[model samples]
Target: MSLLFKELDYRPTPIGVLSLRRRRELSLDIDVYEIKLDDEYLMSSLFTDAEIALADLGLADLAGDSLDVVVGGLGLGYTAKAALDNPKTGKLTVLDTLPEVIEWHQQGLLPLGEQLSGDRRCELVHADFFGASLSDIAGMNPQRPDTRHDAILLDVDHSPGNVLHDDHKRLYTKDGLQKLATHLVPGGVFALWSTELPEPWFEENLAAAFDDIRAEVITFRHPLIDREDINTVYIARKAS
Candidate 1:
């Protein structure tokens, strides 16, 4: 049974109310008029290692004065925030399906957004990462070169196998991966943050889409208040 909802904290952002929910377990939820759990607040969700790795995998290759990054999920804005922290990154466009999630950042529920959004380097868009068309991304920054993303970091669901939303499974499918391929520049890296190692099928699909496909298993300790959990990250790159 869940305990009485206790307030851990709150932030105002693009999503609106970003608050920590203290029940039997700590979770992060958002609300404008209704409540929804984005992920287990302060639990296994906020894995910094995965977030940093996602950003680094892409930034490491680019030599240009300005690098552009596309982040598929904005959970607490950790990955997006980390990308912005990098000097090599010139712009970061974060897309999330839930507008409320964007509000959470815009309103300042996550302080990282508050710090990074105003840098003129961060742009947040409300749309499904999978459904977002190439035209849509191009519209965000018209001057951006064709096949613009230097890095594509996706933290959409738990993993390719353990999907929270049915539609997300497409991301690991061949067709979905093909779409991703179109967005990435030559040699650009695609990083996926997963709760665990993805199925072999995911690797096969990635291989079929990109010339060089690889996965990196990253283990890190969680910063939860109660228990410690180890999380993993999967990194796949497009062959130059």
Candidate 2:
């Protein structure tokens, strides 16, 4: 007999209802963990190549033996987990606007939560990535107020023009880009995962704010759809 578990966890978040579900796939004969916001599916364990690539592509050029990094958003823990997997990453700070999401990681409600929570190098912080001011982040670290991380991996919103919340749209602007650049060390990199490819205005904005910039398309096969879909990762290197 095929076994299935129906202990789906759902909680009301400020934005909407957040849910975490784990169930057995009859045909696949495996467990799949999924997260949803109201009626919209946020993420699933079934696909994580691009999420891992966000960290991989961002920190590709970092030559140092030890690096301090920050990741915005803790969706399925794939990005943070990828950063931890890097031998060069000395410290990792993950920020998420949703407290319920953080609680899921701490409570071991997800597959990778126990491992991520147990890692001494990883710090899961509850903060708004875009809304935070210099002083606010300085509060997270008294010494380094201006530049803190070697890389900042962001997967918070849909894209530059598209956002998950009203307040998050500002981060896509030139002014917002300037604030994020201050967090990276000299020659640091910023990578953003987007459901759509880079828009012209957004690409121009990044070029104006940073040095070299690249937009990559990640194509993957989706069995459910029986077709291939495309996602994008925008990478920009901060001026040294």
Candidate 3:
């Protein structure tokens, strides 16, 4: 591998080939880390405004300290770090279906791995977030089964319409959302990150199970294109 680019690790997962890589950006004089699923780039360290915003916007909706939060994806640990950064956050449970991703953090392979894993407030767990969302008994934290949280931030799929797996499609529906709501404390916040623009139909589905729904568009500079790009963060709160 060239000094500018290196493939750190690769593993075959049920969904696809999971890989972690690091590359040097001479133009910016910075090191960039990336996670990939086969040919598709799952996440990059350079662009994480939306991921951070997912946690910010979600936790911002709630009022109180010692907030119990659950993040539905591990990715590059951007969202998890953001949640832990908030002083209001007390305990954070991060759930991901892939054990490799969770191991990357525990082994300190990723950039934010050490920061997230070292924090006593954060717990990285190997679990299917989508499956837990629809489950009333298991909830987001399998160890603390049936326990509700103050905030639930999700960034697993690309978008409500464009899901990574067919099984994830159910969680986007009104019925699926209603089931997810049961996992949250009353008046708790639920936020989601999407690469595409927010759709009205999805907002309608969220409304069925939540109140004070808001679709926030987060704009950030695209590192590759050197132009503005946008991602959506959907925030909703369960009825009190």
- Ranked by lDDT, the better of candidates 1 and 2 is 2
Write model 2 residue lDDT over 1-240, tens digit each, in one string. 424856468898778998888878776777888888998888888888889999999888898878888888999899999999998998888888888888888999887899889999988888877765333363223234454778889987877778878887767888778777777778988999998976889998888779889999998987566788888999999888
- Candidate 1 backbone overlaps, count: 24
Clashes counted in candidate 2 amount to: 0
Q: Which one is best on lDDT?
A: 3
Candidate 1 residues lying further than 4 Å off, grouped into runs, are 1-46, 133-147, 223-229
Global lDDT of each candidate? 0.66, 0.82, 0.92
Candidate 3 error regions (>4 Å): none
Task: Report the C-alpha lDDT of model 3 over 131-152, residue by residue, as the tens digit.
Answer: 8888768458999996789999
Worst 10 residues of 2 by lDDT: 133-142
TM-score of each: 0.75, 0.92, 0.97
